[model samples]
Target: MKNFILALIVGLLVSACSIQRSAITGDKRAYGYSWEQEKQIGKEADEQIKQHFGVYDNVALQQYVNKIGQEMLAVSHMQREDTPATYKDTEFFFRLLDSPVVNAFALPGGYIYVTRGLLSHLDNEAQLAVVLGHEIGHVAARHASQRAFIQQMSQIALVGGAIAGQHFLGIPGGDLLGIGGMAAQVIFLSYSREDERESDRLGVEYASMQRYKSAEGAQFFVSLERMSAQSGQSIPNWQSTHPDPAERATSIPELAEEWRAIGYEQTIVNTDQYMGMLNNMIYGDNPREGFTRSGTYYHPEMKFQFSYPEGWHVINQRSLVAVVNNDQNAVSIMTLDNESAGAEASVNVFLNQDGITTTGKSGITNRGLQAFQAEATGQTQDGVALKFYLYSIEYDGMIYRFINYTTVDNYGTYGPRFKEITSGFRQLTDSGILNIQPVRLQAVKTTRSGTFRSFLPANLENLVINVTPEDIAIMNQVGLDERIESGTWIKIPR
Candidate 1:
């Protein structure tokens, strides 16, 4: 198959380059997809990207992501001026965030953010290209704008807007007003099965054209499915945006068949290199951005800390953090709202994201507090179901507690974990936590080290380097024919 595709595509390479030359394409794709539409949609969706996940800042990581992104654009059908690529005019930005959410998101202006969690999961550059291209397809197809346009087209936006303005005065501009605790409920309200499937197909084709085997790219999703089942958590972001994994699983193999018939090969999964990039890339969460430690939650900037039950898992995403107990029953998170005068204003800002009512003398308390709970009566779009409890409690001018979610239809596999985490929420004591700075690898020379093994103690502690067979190879290049040196600056493993 590889030999056949290699020979056959020799002639059609240029033809594939002009895939966007025609205004009308095929039923094989979502009709009326144009460059202009993609840009318009990207404009709106970009706002959502900012509102949801802010830009991730890291220089070396960003440069590499853009280089790959540019290569993808050179091979894709997104450059027609009238049908200008979604980010043609914009500078493409890519960076790794210090997050464990395992996500990759694209903003309107070619702003792309990939989490270290997701980076740790990918195998190679080709696989990364496929995922990045799929996101580009979303921008190209105007999915985000289409969804928002459709939302406005329907009465949902109006009713949602009125509800948003009336109760949640602390609502910010643009969409996603109450996004934190309402993810599971509001997700399916966006795209359809057909739209996502089309994106998948096109994504593969784009990858194929770029000479990055789409087959391996498809495997990332497969690996994710297995990882999610093993972790018993909801299928992370790989399949989160696009649901129906079992069916999608079948589709990828089918597409592989299509590419096989037309000549597509698979890329190798380089787990070693992948993990190396993740090493010291900042694990779990950045404590600086408000995460809890020990039995207490602290926000040094927000100037407060909350206590939690022991043995609970804590999650700290930007804007909020929550602790769940072992029973899959309760959770406590945090938020900040400065709109309502005094406590009422803060509480109003916190509840505004979900259209919750913040009226009539809302007071601050500890145990019994203001919160919202959502029950998933049936299955979610991805078929791995969940239920969620969301709310905010405050102390000393700071408001905290968003939601703790659990799996329901899926036999509560992730549910028990969720409960244990949420149940840990409590008030803070006067005790403070000591800070420790994490050591990261710099592109500096080997300041002091006898050997790779000696530098890495038995316990490893803050040591991030992994003497992989490849690193050993690079080490050989040191001070010989090239500038590679003892500490000639390379990324260390997480």
Candidate 2:
């Protein structure tokens, strides 16, 4: 467990500044994480990043990425090492991972990451440069630093509420937690409309300066919006707090117009070459470890896996595990299934819910012991028809919900996914899949005949490659300068 210095400081600052405000609210300005305190906060953020995704390691990829990124930075006003300014000595980094999700982010001291999912969708190098440029702007602008300072402000506000013992801190997500408890969370999520808009402007300006066509970059974001509409959902963390779709759609055109008015020309650099590079790049979902084999589901992380009936699709997220059933006409949502107290109490509490209306109940010991099943149906508060059989089991002192939906079909033919998903609910076991480790990105040097393998370890063969000489020559001139070498490092998803 890493020490959370900002959280600790939040604890300390509240003590000194207990002055109550006219009305309680959670705001970071009340407390302070001065420039002097930034180092500690950065340290904490580093630990958090490591815990979240493990540094995307690919040396060759990092070098190529850093070169392109620094090229963009050359035109940025952020301080360089010699000028004696705020961002001097800042080192930028990149993580290469095959996540299939379009996401990229920057940490306080120039740490940046781009998921392979987004990389695959990009139409060209200029688009890629724009994405990197926008993230670089975040680092240069010190927006995160500003947010951290806001956290301090929130802390002070929290303190005022504690002293007065009042509810509602007048801040976002303000509740009876006295603000002190949820202050950091609030600030982290306080992505005001202004922040996103600013990022868009910065991205466009940076791309324009790099001589990379800014409109091509804008087109990628537009594509993402189209994808979201086709899927009937927006991205998670990437979009949850982003400006509304209409607001977001308007931003890029405005930036493009600004660039055009200033005489910036549009350019497309090697769109086909870019697409060719992704020909064999693992498409859709990764199937090496746990994936939907036919219609079954498997996960190595939880150590237990199960299979569903035929034809049902699965949507796996970081937090929730869900599967839809076609034949049974239902969907199942798998969660931690945690209760306020503990596992045993949770089962009892669920069973005792009002209007449960149990039909046939029985006890079963599928994996081990202490498990029960009940059939019940009721209308959820949203007026959606609900029907299912819930099975509660205690595994590792945790209660798990294995629900089978057979009653309501809100999503219609597609709704069967819910039932197929819940039906596949079962315990995981130690199997061949559990033995495989996820691959990481590693950068390597390529010879005149250099291949991707020289950089990848034996264990990462599932993700290694052999680079071609012609490919190296092209990238050298157009993208990350391809200095031919007998041995060098490049990035690859592990």
Candidate 3:
């Protein structure tokens, strides 16, 4: 998220004189950044995105998505004959993020990303084409640049922090310590309703040109609608911005029909191929990164464990884990200091920051690990006074820093809770917790024709956390009572 912070700051610092013609309509329009500047911004943001949400590790799946994206691009406005020369040859980058959120989005330039969670919900390649085409439409239409033109830069910054707080800390304006940047930008990049509708039209047009069954795209929206209704909230990264999944479910087919009337023969629906690609794919949360149980957090991969106060929320990402208080005023963060050689060296970096005044510093030991502890007071960028209790532990040749902080006025109330959590940090030793594996999609062929529910294992809950027959049905794009033919491949969590 720090990269997101830098991206926002860099965006704010850009010159405002830049303007450019629309890539899709060829009409002269005002833009926040020149076309060349957009490319540079996207290149910088792309690096941060990869770091924030690690690329999905499957090489074959990555190539498959890229191939589809390139095909969609060929038919998009960016590649059309009327497109300006400056944009006609813009290279597009399509990436599958390892995150489990159902989302697909485009950066200001030609950077596009789809999450593994979205892939898990898709039933066919044509649906994927439409999703990729939808994102490509955003880039082709210069939606982000247009938004930047109409929005106040300061408002965008506030929106970034608000999204980070809400998503990570479960509070609308909670200040998440270290995990606030690029990921927040993802939610911050949500388009207007008009932009979304335009993207939908462009998506159908591009997918239709490629002869995909563009109408199949509607089914994915149906899945999204069901997911939203079941969760009682919009799906993260997607529905948050692209609202009205149920409404889109109706319009998508109408758009496809419009294309058919124009002589586009949409017929492709590579279900088997898509299903084959999904076999053995990871589903739900990847617990190897970290998981919480009975108030203790454990990282099997990192081989560490810690305890947070009961009722505090935990947001665990590939880079770090943040624990937030119920009131969202206090936060404790844990992250690696890869560059620092030892605990004391890491502590120095924290103490040297501007506006920070150290009140106490000492060498200490925690759970048999060498560590340095420090107490400091400082004011935030917004001039909010705060107190900090920091720790840097050296264990197995790596420095793990725990940053605990709260508003100066509330420090007395939450200070003990912070100390208790950091002091509880220890090496993970339980064999069962260390060996837990992530649930994965198992592509199973039905032995006999039956309702989709009948094909699921009786111990469905045991196979995956918080999953149900209805959830699996929605994932397979079928109904719980729908009869599934024998020998047909369907995904089951295992």
Candidate 4:
């Protein structure tokens, strides 16, 4: 009875809030957050995203994307002559994230991001314009706000039903209240198919108005289709948040034709300039960051190596490296403590954290490096007890921290494995491993007419990670058997 009453009060309070006008449609609608609140949310989330993905370290590339984004934004509904005064001058921020995942997305406000992986797959500036415009459409249309509003309304009904069931039918509402709060945080990450279709139309419109070859966007979708098929994860349009890539590939050209018929005359595909920008761009995973070989993980740039347990899964990121046991119950993580002056200081910082109880502490030495070892007990946010084996080593004027943890019940089974992995850390000195460099995309001009496959070196796959002739063909938006003319520019991984 109390829960039901509380839910009713919450719903009524939400219903009483003022509605806002959409930036695109200019129609008053109920949104979960005001425009100002949406901006603040995006501002805060943008910081987290920068820290997580690390911005791509290319000022020229970033400025080029921003320049294109600004051009598209000018033609968008948010900046049109008839747009509301409140939205007319809204600032849009475009960022290039240093990730190898082919993805692009927009936040609730005007924050947009594209990965270098996506940039590498693009063929021309017009395609990039369409992509940025698509993300801009999402922001201009307030799709995130609409999705949040719908999510909140659904949560209200769910909460009301759960409370009613508990009060009348004596059914337990297992953590239903907590789910709403968690779901709200990630609501902007995805959108409905209708929202996607609307953005696609708006994308073509904006790019076409800019005199770009908006139909070029269709080739990018074709590459996406090939990628999906190669990854073996193709799904029906009904099960996807966005329309099928093949469908989009066919529709994008038609959308461009519609704009052309109405006097847009979209014809601006700067292929040479776009290809020049991609010259020597990082292609796939950078082994200089960290890479696993055999049972050891090596960091060529940091000049360190560590042995992980055999058969354990290893994940290397910019900030840390994680090794997980097969059953997924235990994990060992290594991170650089840039703020700490010494090994003991790093371990002390960990021990001083709230809710962390140090059970044991001792001095240790590994590979002639000064180190500190400690055992601690802590409870996760979910109240599950964990046993931690912490090790910190000072080497080359830097502190490297290894944090290994498992459930208290499973500590006995995994404690030795954790210790062995951490103890194996040592300076990386092999000349071959230290000199390894990341593969980069190289622009090559064909000297003789031949099929695309014949242009590639036989050992192309050996030089690049997870790359094949077909993959290179897809990157160039060509078929493997497609003929190439002499003096034509093509990208090859080198």
- Give TM per candidate: 0.54, 0.51, 0.92, 0.88
Instruction: Name the candidate that leads on lDDT.
Output: 3
Kindly report which residue stretches of model 1 are placed more than 4 angstroms away from their true locations once superposed.
Answer: 1-48, 80-97, 105-113, 144-189, 238-279, 293-295, 300-303, 308-315, 322-333, 337-432, 437-494
Q: Compared with the true structure, what per-residue lDDT tens digits does model 4 show for residues 1-494?
A: 99999888777757744489887778898877777777877887677667656898889888989999999999899887889877786788999988777888887778999888888889889999999999999888888777767766666432222311231112122122212222226332358989999999999999999999999999999988888887687532212689989899999999999999999998799888888888888888888888888899999998999898888988677767878788777888788898987898899998999999999999988879999999999986678789889999999989999888888899999999999999999999999999998888888778999999888877875773678787888888899999999988898888
Model 4 scores worst on lDDT over the 10 consecutive residues at 167-176
* Per-residue error (Å), model 4, residue 37: 2.0
Each prediction's whole-model lDDT (CA): 0.49, 0.53, 0.84, 0.82
Tens-place lDDT digits, model 1, residues 1-494: 98787656543432322123321131222222244544443455554445545555556665667777776665555554454433355444455555656677554334456776566556567677777776666655545444544443332422222111222112221222334322211223345566577667767777777666666665566656655665567554444447665566667667756876776665544434443444455543454566555676665544555556667765555655645556533444445544444444444443455433323333334356443323232223455444444445444654444544445443355444444443444544434432433334322235654444433324434332223433322222121133333543333333
In angstroms, the error of model 4 at 369 is: 2.1
Best by TM-score: 3
- The positional error of residue 143 in candidate 1, measured at the CA in angstroms, is 3.5
Residue 89, model 2, lDDT = 50
| Candidate 1 global lDDT | 0.49
Candidate 3 C-alpha lDDT tens digits along 295-352: 9999998889999999998988777788988888899888899988889889889899
Model 4 bad stretches (over 4 Å)? 1-18, 156-188, 234-239, 381-383
Writing each residue's lDDT as its tens digit, candidate 2 over 376-482 gives 66655556556656666666666666655544444444334443444345666556666645433233344543333333345433432333332222222212232
